[model samples]
Structure formats: structure tokens, C-alpha cells
Target: MGGFLSFVKKETLHIVRDRRTMMIALLMPVVQILLFGFALSTEINNIDFAVTSPNRTEAVRRQVERIAANPYFTFKGYIAPNEIDNALRSGRADAVAVFADDYDRQTAATERGEPAEKAVQLIFDASNPNNAAAGAGYMQSILLAGRQTGAAAPETRLLYNPQMKSAYNFVPGIMGLIFILICAMLTSVSIVREEETGTMEVLLVSPVRPIRIIFAKMIPYFLLSCLNLVSILLLARFVLGMPMSGSLAGLVGISLLYLMLALALGLLISTLANNQVTAMLISGMLLMLPIIMLSGMVFPIENMPGILQGVSCIIPARWYIEAVRKLMIEGVPFADVLREVLILAAMTAVLIGVALRKFNDKLE
Candidate 1:
């Protein structure tokens, strides 16, 4: 009994002495609560909107004013009918309200107990299909309310994300979470463990090049991460009943690219850490938390503060998640996700180059 008690006391003291572990234990809950509390929200607001009227009649003016007055929309004022497409393509507008010259005439006809077709058109930038669908729905509700008489509702046209399923948003986010957590945390801890046990010094003395050694260690984990990716996709499909609407080959290729980026990031973390505990803390607190909170995994980047949205730009998970959503949910071709693929590729190259440079410096 006394021996057992002494062992417990000694272990407790050791834990107390380990500042990295102690700090992680103390700070983790606080950090998670603050991040999740502040960042997680589904409520969409402040949607950018453009208005175009062929005749600019009182009815058109009233409809525009009503839409602009809504809390969800930020009206960018009237643009030329020709400029509406450019505005959406340039990301200057999320939705466009186009009123035909016959809008007032149609409304008058409806009021006079006659069948009339309303010429109000609502066109959405379906790039983020979820937001586009939701915004369009809200606008439709508003238009319906404004129709005191039996007037025809506005015609809605969706561009890209037509289904607007919540699953489409979450599946890609889950992929980002799995890849980053598995690749970065696991690799960082695995490499740092050897350093703590003094085995890294022995390996460094061997004929094997340090870069090669790093790659050899990472290859198995990379394969394991791939397996995990497949498992996740299976579960998402069969269990969650989510549809994979995109090309399977494209999804796999992009996922592999993201996996490499994550692995490279893990190697970067390992290079900075002196021990496994530090690596774990850095991966969990710095990498995992941001991936969840700032990477558009749990929160919409558009709803975030401008500064936080800017911060999300640097998170590789953000790009990958967006790419996967576009591909898998929207069934977009590889050409559509080209920018995301290129960004991940560039980031992977930079991280690998930097990690190798640092490893060589350490070897010297």
C-alpha cells in the first residue's frame, strides 16, 4: 500500500514538473470553449446584393428598398443590367434582383383581377450553394409578404450549388478534420518521440540521409491517413447517407494532395518541437483548434469578422474543405477546383522545403 502511494505521489510530482503537459492541461478547456463559443454559428446574414431595374418604376424602387431594408442583405445599389453578371463573377454580389420593364404593369394587372406574370427575377451566385439557396429563400419570403394582392412571385434561378444540403457542407469539413488531425498530430508526435528517447541521434549518425529518414518515417502514416480518408468517405456515404455527386477520381486526387500538405505541416511541427509532449500540444492547440474554428469547418467564413476571415485565408484546411465541398457536393469539374489544388500544392512544397532546410541545419 505504501509503495503504491509513493508511486502515485512521484508520478503526480513528475506531471507537475512537466510545464508543457501542465500548460496544455490547464489551457485546453479554456481555449476550446472560447473558440467554439465564438466561432460556431449557422445563422447567415449580411449577404451582398445587387439590384437592376430596366424601367426603375415605383414598384421596382419599393421592392429594392424592401430587400435592402432586410437585416440579412447589404444592398450595393443599382447596377446596369449588363453589369449584373460581372458583379456576381467578380464576387461583388452574392445575388442580383432584376426587375423587367413590365414589372409595374404586371403588378397593376394582378390588382385589377386579371392573371399577370410578374417580371421580378432573383439570380443567385451558386458558388456557395448553401448560402445562395438560403438567401434566395429569405428573399422569396419577403417578396411573398409584399404581395398584398395576388401577384406572381419572383422567379428564382440557382447557378452552382443547387441542392444546398447541410451534409455537403459537413462532409468536406470532416475530411479536413481527419487529414489535418491524423497527419499533423500523429507525425509530429512520432518523430518527436524518437528525439526524446535519444534514438534520433543514433539514426542521424547512420548513412541514411535525414530527408530520406523523415520520408521513410512518414510514408507509413501517409498510407494510414489515406485509409482513414477512405473509411470516412464510406461512413459518410453509407451511414450518413450523404451522396458523392462528383467524380470519384477527382475527389481522391485532391484528397491525396491535401493529405500531403498535412503531412508536410506535421514535419514542420516536428522540426520545431524538442519532445513529444511539446509536439502534441502544438498540434492539438495550434493546429487542430484553428482547423476546427477558423477553417470554415464549423463556421461559415463569410459570417466571421473580416479579420478572422482574413486569418482563415492562410489555413490550408480552409482551401481543401472548400475544394472538397465544391467537388463532392456541387459536382464541379477539376477545373473548378484548380485554384484550391494549386494553393495546397504550393503550400506543401513550401512546408517540405522549409522542414528539410531546418532538418539539415540541425544535422550540421
Candidate 2:
């Protein structure tokens, strides 16, 4: 009994002594609860709603006021018919309300000679099928609020995904998850495994600078990640029948940049981890959850709590998924993805710089 108790006590002390183990044992549950509490939401809120009226009649103007008064929407002011496409592409609006030129005259009762036109047109960015559907429902309730018996339902159209396919949303999200999994987690583990087995020191003994040496180790993984990228694109295009509406070259270029950023992120992770297991643990704990929850993959960021939404801005996968969705699904031009590209580039540069500075010369 004494020996058994001693063994248990020794193991307990070992776990308590290892900070990483302690964090996983004690803090992981805390993190999971917090994320689930604030980040897991399907309800649509804070939709950026815009209105476009070629002719602003009293009826159209009054319907616009009704939509504006709704708590669910952020009422972007009236835009031109020509500006609707640009507004959606530029993220200026989530859904646009378009009124026909003779809307008021057409909606006039046929008790006279006039025919009733459709009440309004709701154009959604539909990259997220769920959001598009929910936004349509919300707009319908608002537009047809008092006139449920009289008004014609709003004419709803989904941009980018007229079919409203869920596949269009998840494919890019899966690509983001896979790129980070292969490039960052695998690279981190491979480098840390070398450190664990002392092979890293051998490679570092060469005349080359240590940063270059460490990064050279990442070359094979980067190539492997590229192969995975090609595989995903092929499957997404051929098997899934997803449309590649934007510039294929632009998508490929941005994907390569994302892969590089993932590689740098791996190098940074390896610098922090002492052993292969720790590297994998840190990668899973830090990278996986954020990629799933905060990357805007399964959940809409705008629906999350303010702090988690802000934290999402720093998550590399969030920007990658957004860019991919824009190019792959929405068919936005390369210029339209400029903001995402710049943010990713800045993140890559920062991670690489930190990894080089933090990498220690001696194996401790």
C-alpha cells in the first residue's frame, strides 16, 4: 500500500511541476467553457443592411424607415443601384434592399388599374448560406410587418450562392483548417521532434545561420502543404462542383501566402515548445480551437461576444477563410481581397521575426 501511494504521489508531483501539463489539466476546461459560452451562436445579429431606391417614393421611404428601426440591422444609408454590387463586395453591407423604379405605383391596389409589384428585393452576400437565410427571414418580417394580409412578399435573391449551398461556406473553411493543421502543427512537431532527438543540434552545427537552418527544415513540409492545397482545390472543384468564379491565379497566390504564414507560425510554436508532445499539445490547445470557433468557420464572428470578435481579428485562419470565401465563392477580384492579404502578410512577417529572435542557440 505504501509503495502504491508513493508512486501515485510521485506522479502527482510530476504533473504539478510541469506547467504545460498543469495548463492542459486545469485550464483547458476553463478555455472550452469560455469559448462555448461566448462564441457558439447561430442566431444572426448586427447585419449590415443597406437600401437602394432608384425612385424614393413615400412607400419605399417608409419601408426603409421600418427596416432601419429594427434592432437586428445596422442601417447603411441608401446606395445607388450601380453601387449594390460594389457595396456587397467591399463588405459595406451584408444585405441590400432594392426598390424598383415604379415600386410605389405598382404596389398601389388593383382596386384601381395599377398592378401590385413585388414589395422589395433582398440581395444577400450568401457566402454564408445560414446568414443569408436568416437575414431573408428577418427582412420579410420587417417589410411585411403590418401588411401581411396585403403586401406581396419580398423578392429574395442570394448573390454568390443563389442555390444557397452549405458546401460553398465549409470548403474554404476546411482549406483553412487543413493548411494550418499540415503546415503549422506538423512543422512544429517535426522541428520539436528533432530537438527532442538531438538531430536539430547536428543540423545547426553547419556554417549557415541558425534562422535559415531552422527555416530550411520547413521546406519539405511547405511543399507537402502545397500538394494538399492542390488536392483540396481539385476536389472542391471536381467532386464538390464548386464554382471557381474569381481569378484562379489570385486564389492560388493567396493560398501560397497563407501556407507560408502557417509555416512561420509553426516555427514560432517550435521555439516555445521543449519536446514533441508539448509542441503538439500547444498547437492543439492554441491553434485548433481558434481555427474552429473564432476563425468564422462554423460561427459568424459578428454574433460572438465583442471580446471574442476582437480576438478573431488576430487569428490568421479568420482572414484566410474570409479571403478564400470572397475569391472562391463570391468571385470577388484580387483587388477586393487586398485587405485580407495585407493583414496576413503583416502577421507572417511578425511571426517570422519573433521566431528568429526567440530561437535559442543552446539546447536546454
Candidate 3:
């Protein structure tokens, strides 16, 4: 136990010795949190809204007033019916509320038990889907809220995700990306550094088995990655307001499986690369691009071409992120994630086997 502790202590010290790298690693998540908090948001706080009314009924004026008074929209006043295209094209309005010429009559007739179609039309700029969806929903809610009960036959109800927060989609992706990169890069670089510094030979000659040494070396990074996983979950739940709708134990179990896969992949990279730089290049750039582009992190895999989709099947983050979204967002049962768990376990076992084989050969 003492000897194992010493080995872990040494590896931890080695990891933290580089102040610059340590700072970058620690601050990277903070930067991501800031960017996700501010820049990557799809919440529609302020959207420009315009109105078009041929007859300028009191009902239209009241509706426009309500929209303008609400904080979600910036009322851009009324536009001519002919200028709808111009307004939308010029970006002068994100959405235009069009009222029928007989809007007042429609409302009055409906109140009197006479049939009348929808008197108001909502035209939105679909260029920004977030704005378009949110804006249209906002306007619909406002209009519906103003009407009496039974005035509208149908109602809109958003279940599970009522607010439509975009962070829910991003949190799992970021977690999958961040944990794998940090764990893999740290493990690979530490091993490669020992090789580069000529210290590996001295360690290899000692009483410890090569696999034991490699496993011991990986211990610190695994714990660190676990802490990182916890911190990420906390950030996702509290700061980002993302829900832990599923089982916490389930999330942790799956994440630890992914971490093992990441560390094993790092070992595999360390076996391939002779130096720290090469290991970092292989782990960072080579892994990052595929994870970001093909892992269904930022884009849907089903939408990709057959070749890219096939390529994505091999990316570890693809399965991990998919499992996370299911567990964290969709709140599926543990049984639901059996496929991801099985695939990741197989990948981890294969990587560990291959890495250990190469490591033993190199030691011999």
C-alpha cells in the first residue's frame, strides 16, 4: 500500500509540476463554461417583432401593445402588407404578426357563437430556428393567454422540456469531449515523457511488473478525471440548470466506463508515439476533430453521409455522448443504455489488451 501510494504520489506530482500546462488544463473548463453561458445560448431574450394590419383594428393594436410590453420581443411597429418581404429580407424584423382586415369582426362573431377562422397570423424568420420557434411560441402563448377559456379549442403543451433550454443538448457533449480529452492526454503525455527522459528503463528494471507500473501510473489521472466528472455534473446541474432526471449512480457508472476507455486509449497512444509531443498530437488534434465533428456532439450522425456516419461508429465519444444524452436528458433506464455500456467495455478491454502487449514488448 505504501509503495503504491508513493507511485501514485509521484505521478500526481509529475502531472502538476508543469504550472503552465496545469493552469491551461484547469482553466479550459472555465472558458468552456463561460462560452456556453454567454455565446452558445439559443434562448431568445430579445427578438424584433413587427405587425401588419390592413384594417388596423383595435384588436390588432391591443395585440401589438401586448407583444411590445413583453420583455421577449422588441416591437418594431406596424409594416405595410407589401413590405413583409422587404422587412424580413432587410433583417428589420425577426417575426411579423399579421392581423386579418376583419380581426375585430372575427373576434366579435366568435364571441356570438358564429364560426370564424384564426384572425391572426404569425410570420417568423426561420433563418434562426431558435428565434423563429421561440418567437412564434411566445406570440402564441401571449395571444392564448389573453383569450377567455374555450375561446381556443386546442392548446400547446411542452412536456419533459418545457423551457426548451439549449444547454441540455450541449452539456452532455461537452462532458463527453472534456473528460476523454483530459484523461487521455494526461495519461499519454505522462508515459511518453518517461520514455523521452530515459527514466522508463530504470523503472522497467525494478521489481514492479510492466502492467502494474502502467496501471499505477494511470491511477492519479483516473481519480482526477473522476473529480472532473463530478465537477462537470455539478456545473451542468446548478449553473446550467440541466437536470439529473435519471439515476445519479447510473450516470457515474457510465462515465467511469468512459474514463477507463479514455485512459486505455491513452495507453494505446503512448505505445504508438515515441515522444510527448507526438503523443499529445495523436491524442489531442486527432481525437478532438472526430469527437467534435462526428461524435454527434454538435451535429446529428443520422444526417451525415454514409461514409462519415460509418467513420463515427468507431469514435468512442459518439457512443459515450449518446449514452449520456439518454441517461441525463431523456432519463432512460439503465437497461436502455446496455448497448453503449457493452460497446465501451469491449473497446476498453481491446485497447487495454493491445496497449499492454505493446508495452510488454517494449519493456522486453
Candidate 4:
């Protein structure tokens, strides 16, 4: 017991005195959150479009005004009838809406119970899927609503992000995922590094129990992760104006629990890896890839093929990402996230057990 306490003290001292550990555990998450929030976004806003109306009638003018007034669109000067391809190729236009010379004739035909004699040409840039989809949806909604009620729908409901902003969704999950990467995989490599440098041997030869050494190495990381959670939430609220829909305390509790799981995973990897370099390589390829790919951080799991969806079930980050989004975006109750919390708890238990068994074997 005395040996364990002494080892814990020594471990704490090592962590606190080391600048690299502090930077990895704390600074990395902050930088990643900011970078991803700014660079990676799904929200399509103020997309430029070209309009070419050969007839330039009053109906076409009204249609152009409608598209221009929408928050999702910006008028990018008129395009010649033949310049639609050029405008799209030069990246000057996301879409082009062309009104036929007899557009009034079509409206008149429909009103007069006759066959429509004209149609509008909508040329879209399909490369930017989100923008294209938004542009199409906006055009469809405007025309449908105007033809029916002459206004936008007042009953529209956005399920997750009411503002339809990408930052709100991506930042929360990215923040959680980045912390997992830094905390779990990096901590694993750090412990293995000590072994490579002979520091682990020096500690093992001392009076410390293996359990104490493991827990001590993990304590600083745990604290750092908690601090990271607080900072991220602050940034999301203040910088990006994202609201936390669930209880802050509950979210914090879950974050700490996930951090512990990450620490155990690190310890498990540390025990298995022959050296620090191998540990980092293995964790990055094996653990990090699955977390980033399967966690639905950037890709929707439901949209993935059946085999990949089945594989995603085993990823810890998927649960963590889901929990974070639910808390931050959906404002779900603690009870709602209970199943995910339980699954995480079970995974932590297994990792800790595996780590302890491996450490025992190494000692023997």
C-alpha cells in the first residue's frame, strides 16, 4: 500500500513536470476543435447562382426576386444563354435557373386548363452535394409554396440543428473524437515510450505495484480530459453559439467515464506493444481509423453499407460521438443515453481486465 502511494506520487510528479504530456492532453483537443469548426462544415449558405431569362418577362423577374431574397442564395449577375457551362466550370455559379421565352404562356396555360407549353431549365453543380441539395430544395420549396400559398412554409421543423448550421453538429463530435485520439492512443504510446527508454523498468524495480503505476499514469490524462470538455463546451457556446440541450452535469459524467475507458485502452495497448513506435503505429491504424470512420463523426452510419454498419457497432467512439451529439444537439435526458453509457462501462471493464492480466503476465 505504501509502495502504491509512493508510485502514484512519483507518476503525478512526472506528468506535471513534463511539458509534452500537458500539450498532448490539453492543447491538442483545443486546436483540433477550432480547426475542424472552421474548416469542416456542412451548412450551405449564400451560394451564388446565375439566372438566364431569354424573355425577361414580369413572371421571370418575380421568380428571380424570390430566389435572390432567400438566405441560401446570392445573385451572381446574369449569364448568357450559352454561358451556363462556362459559369459552372469557372466556379462562378453553383446553379443556373433559365426561364423560357414563353414562361408566362405556361402559367397561363395551366390557369386556362390547357397543356403547359414551356418549362424552366435548372442547371446545377453536383460537385458540392450539400449546396446542390440545398439549392434544389430551396427552389422546389419556393415554387411549390408560391404556387400554393405565395409564401414560405411557416410550419417547417428542423430536427437536430434548427439553424441548419454545420458547426453546431460537426464541432461537438469532432471535439469528442479528437480528445479520444489524444487521450487514448497518445497515452498508450507514452507508456510504451517509458518502457523503451528504460524508465518503466526503473519504476518496476522500485517498490511500486503495477496497478499503482498504471492508475498513476492515467490520472493526469483523466484530469486533462475533464478540462478539455469544459473548454470545448465554452467554445461551442460562446464562439459558435451552440446550445447544450441536455444536463451539463450528465454530459460531464459521461465524458469522464469515456476518458476512463480511453485510459484503460491505452494501458491495454501499452502492455501489448513491444515498443513505443509500434504502439503508436498500431493504435493509429487499428484504433484511430475505426473511431474516425465508424463513429459517424463525418459519415452517417445508417447510410453506410451493411457490412460497415455492422462493424461500427464495435467502435467506442461511435457511442461517445452519439452521446455527445445527443447531449449537445438533441438535449436528451440522462435516461435516454443510458444504454450507451452502459455499453461504454462494459467496454471499460473489459479493457481494464485485459490490461491487468497482461501486466500480471509481464510481471511474472
Candidate 5:
């Protein structure tokens, strides 16, 4: 225990002295958090729309004018009935609201339960989901306020998202996986680099035991990584306004477990690799790719192909992402995260054991 504490102290000192490691552990998370939180958003606003109201009657014109006045929509111009297809095909319009001659008659007949001769056809480019959702929402609001005041509300609602915000789904997972990558993968290479440089040899030959050396190397990075985690959480909540519906303590606890897993993975990589460059290549390709691809950070795991979903089961990042998202976004209790936490702990223990055995072999 004394040797471990002394080695931890030495490792912390070494990390603090190394400027590059400091930058990676501290700066990368802040930059990634800000970029993903602010720069990438699926929220739609000021969508372009075109109308081809050929009826040209006073009533039809007035309704078109009302829709144009809505802030949620921006009308480009009118097109001929035939040109509506050309405009939509050429990507000149997201939607074209066309009023047939019987539109006015249809309005009156719809109240009396009789189908009219012609209907208002809203032709839209259904390619972009965000644009389509925004267009549909704006059109529905316009029709509801202007025409459907007494109409019965549609039943059997299927919510697009209960929260309907991009961050509500994305930020939590991004934060978790990014933290793991920055802290674990980045730190792993730095420590392994020292071993390859003969500097680690000098320390091991001195009074330092293997356990102390590992602990010293880890403590500073562990603290710095924790700071990075805090920054991500703050950005998600205070800046992006993503709700932290669960206990902060629960999140921090789970985060610590994940960090340990990352640190252990780093230690394991450093132990096995011949040099710093090899450590980085191995960590980035073998660990980082699996984490980012399978972790549900950018894509839904449920939507993945059967083989990919099965592959996701082995990804530590996937478990970490799910655990942190549930804790922070959905407000899942610590008990709910317990199974994931246990899995992470088990993985960490296994990696640490392997790393220790490898380190001992190197020393011999």
C-alpha cells in the first residue's frame, strides 16, 4: 500500500510536468463538448416554402397571405400549378401548397360532412426529416388556427420525441463516450511513451515499486479527466439546456467507474505495446473506433443491423454511454445503472490484472 501511494505520487508529478499530456486530458474534452453541443443541431427554423394557389380567389389569396405571415415559415414565391412539380424536383422548394378551384367549396362541404370536388394538395420534398417535420408542424399550426377550430383532435398520437429536442437525445451519450476516449485513450499513449523512452526503466530500477509507479502515473490524469467530465456535464446542462433529470452524484459515481476502466485500458495498452507510437495506434484503432461506432453516440443501437447490435455488446463505450445517458438525461437511479457499473468494474479489473502481469514480465 505504501509503495502504491508513493508510485501514485510520482506518476502524478510526471504527468503534471508533461505539457502535452496535460493538454490532451484537459483541453480536448472542452473543445469537443462545445463543438458537438453548439455546432451540430437538428433543430429546424426559417424553412423555405413555395405556394401555387391557382384558385387566385380572394379567400384563397387571404389564406396564402396568412401562411406567409407566419414567422415559423418563409414563403419564397408562387409557382404555376404545373411548375410546382418542377420546383420541387429541382429542390427549389421544400413544400408547395396548391389551392384547387373547389378549395372554397370544399371548406363549406367539409363542415356538412360531404366530400368536396377538389382539395388543397400540399406537395413537399420528403427527403430531409428535419425539414419535413418543421414544414408539417408549421402547416398544421396554420390549418388548425385558421380552419380546424371545431375539428376533433387526432387520436392515437405517436410522439416524434417526447422532448422533441436534439440535445435531449444526443448530448448525454456524446459526453460519456468522448470523456472515455479523451481520458483513457489519450492518457494510455502518454504513459506508454515514457516506458518506451527508458525513463520508465530508470524509475523502476530506482526505489519505486511497480504499484507505486502505476498509481503516480494515474492520479493526475484521473483528476484532470474528472474536470473534463464536469465541463461536459456543465455544457450539456447550463449551456445547451439539456435537462439533468437524475442525481448528479449518481452520474459522478458512474463516471468514476468508467474513467477507471479507461485508465486501466490505457495501462494495459502501454504494457503490451513496444513503443508510444504503437500504443497510440493500438488504442485509437482497436479501442476508440469500437467505442465511437458501437456506443450509440451518433446512431441508435436499436436501429443497428443484427450483427452490429451483437457487436455493440462488447464495447465498453456503449455501456458507459448508456449508463451516463440514463443517469443524466432520463434521470435513471443508481440502482438502474448498477448492472452497467458492475460490467465496467469487471472489465477494469480484468484489464488491470493483465496490465499488472505484463508490467511484471517487462520488469523481469
Candidate 6:
């Protein structure tokens, strides 16, 4: 017990003495949270909308006023029908709404249960499909609200995230990204550094067993990564206004499994790499890109090409992100995320087994 405690203390002191490693493990997560929280967003707002009315009746003016009052849209003044194309082409407007001359009559007819021609024509610039789709939906809502009678209107309700805040989606993804990068990259580099400095041989020759030495090396990083995870969760809940609706214990358990997988992956890299620089390169260049691109962090996996979707299956971050989204945002039960949990557990076991075998072979 005394020897184990001394080894843990030695590893802890070594980590604390290294300023660069400390900054990467501590400061990087905070910076990434701030960057992703503020800058990265998918919610559409402040769209430039142009309107044209041929007759300019009081009813048309009233409808226009309602459209301008919407928070999502900024009215860009009325445009001529001929200028509609130019408005969209020049980026002067994201969409154009042309009211028919008989808009008032058509609306009144519809209210009286009479069949009427469509009262409005909405032309949108589909250059950005997401923005176009959201803008069109917003316009439709405005039109429906402007109607005098509510009897025939369809009621829409958004679940899970009613306001459609992008942070709700990004926070979990950023959590996965930070954990994987920090644990894997830092562990790999730390292990490789000992090899480069000829210290690994001294440790191997010590009274401690090889497996015990490896655990001693890993203990400090595991604790540090746990601290980082707690810090991220606090920021997400208190600072970013994202609430955890699921079981806290479940989240912690899943996160710990993911961290273990990351650490083992790093150990594997360290065994394969000849030096700290090579380990860093492999962790950053190889792992980071796949985590970001194929993990469904920024893009929906369903929207990707079939081949890319198949390729994304092997990326561990994908499962972690999906599990977090289900637990944190959707408030699903542990049973719902059992598949993700099993996959992560399997990954951790495989990585740890392979890494241990390689480390023992290297020692021999």
C-alpha cells in the first residue's frame, strides 16, 4: 500500500511539475467550451426578407407589419416583382414574399369556408438549404398567425428543445471532443516522453511490476481528466444554461468509460510511436480529424454519403456524442443508451488489452 501510494504521488508530482501538460489538460477544455458555445451555432436569425404587394391595400399593409414584427426576420422594404431575382442574387434579401392583388379577398374567402386561390408566393434563395428551409417555415408561421380565424390552422409544437438553441446540440459534442483529445493525446505524449528521455528503462528495472508502473503513470492523468469532465458539465449547466435532465450518475459512468477508452488508445499510440513528436502527430493529425469530421459533431450522420456513414461506425466519439445527446437533451433512461454503453465498454476492454500486451512486449 505504501509503495502504491508513493508511486501515485510521484506520478502526480511529475504531472504538476510539467507546465505545458498542465495547460493542455486544464486550459484547453475551457477555451474549447467558450469557442464552441459562442461562435458555433445552427439556429437561423435576423434574415433579410423582402415583400411586394401589387394593390397595397390596408390588409396587405397589416400583413407586412406582422411579418416585420417577427424576431427572426428583418424587413428589407418592398421590391418590384422584376427586382425579386436581383434581390436574392445580390444577397439583398434571403427571401421575397409577393402578395397577390386579391390577397385580401382570397383570405376572406378562405375564412368563409370558400375555396380560394393561394394568396401569397414566397420565393427563397435555396443556396443555403438549412437557412432557406427555416426561413420558409418562419414565413409560413407568420402567415398562419396573421389569419383572422384560428379554426382551420395547424398547431405546431417543438419537443426536447422548443427554442432550437444550437448550444443544446453543441455542448455534448464539445464534451466528447475535449475528453478524447486531452486524454489520448496527453497520455500518448507523456508515455513517449519517458521513452525519449531513457527514463522508461529505469522504471522497467525498478522493483515495481510493469503493469503496476503503467497504472502509476496512468493514475494522475485519469484523475485530471475526471476533473476536466466535471468542469465541463458545470459550465454546460450553469454558464451555458444547458440543464441535465437525466440521471447524473448515468452521465458520470458513461463519461468514465469513454475516458478509459481514450487513455487506452493513447497508450496504444505511445507503444507504436518512437518519440513524443510522433505520438503527438498521430494523436492530433489522425484522431482529431476523424473525431471532428465523422463523429456527427458538426454534421448529421444520416445526411452523409452511405460510404461515409459506414466509415463513421468505427469512430468512438460518434457513440459518445449520441449517448450524451440522448441523456442530456432528450432525458432518456439508461436503458435507451445501453447500446452506446456496451460499445464503449467493449472498446475500452479491447484497447486496454491490446495496449497492455504491447507494453509488456516492449518491456521484454
Say which candidate scores most in TM-score.
Answer: 6
How many clashes in each structure?
0, 0, 0, 2, 7, 0
In terms of lDDT, model 6 sits at 0.88
lDDT string for model 3 (248-273, tens) is 88899999999998898888889889
Model 4 agreement with the true structure over 219-278: per-residue lDDT tens digits = 766777778888888888887778887988888888888888888888878888989788
**Candidate 5: deviation at residue 234, Å?**
1.7
Give the residue spans of candidate 1 off by over 4 A.
Answer: 1-151, 154-164
lDDT of residue 199 for candidate 6 = 88
Ranking of all predicted structures according to TM-score, beginning with the best and ending with the worst:
6, 4, 5, 3, 2, 1
The TM-scores of all predictions, comma-separated, are 0.59, 0.60, 0.84, 0.89, 0.85, 0.91
RMSD of 6: 2.3
Each prediction's whole-model lDDT (CA): 0.77, 0.78, 0.84, 0.79, 0.76, 0.88
Per-residue alpha-carbon lDDT of candidate 2 for residues 177-212, written as tens digits (9 for 90 to 100): 777876788778867887889866775675555665
| Least well predicted 10-residue stretch by lDDT in candidate 4 | 144-153
TM-score of 1: 0.59
Cα deviation of 271, candidate 5, in Å: 2.2
- Whole-model lDDT for model 2 versus the true structure? 0.78
lDDT of 1 by residue, 5-29 (tens): 4434543454457678546534433
User: Scored by Cα lDDT, where does model 3 land?
Assistant: 0.84
Question: Per-residue lDDT for 229 in model 1?
Answer: 70
Native-to-model Cα distance after best TM-score fit, residue 234 in candidate 6, in Å: 1.1
- 316 in model 1: Cα distance from truth in Å? 0.4
Error of 2 at 344 (Å): 0.4
Over 107-185, each residue of candidate 6 has an lDDT whose tens digit, in order, gives: 9998898999999999999999989998999898888888857666777788888888788888888888888787898
Q: Identify the leading candidate in terms of lDDT.
A: 6
Give the better candidate number (1 or 4) by lDDT: 4
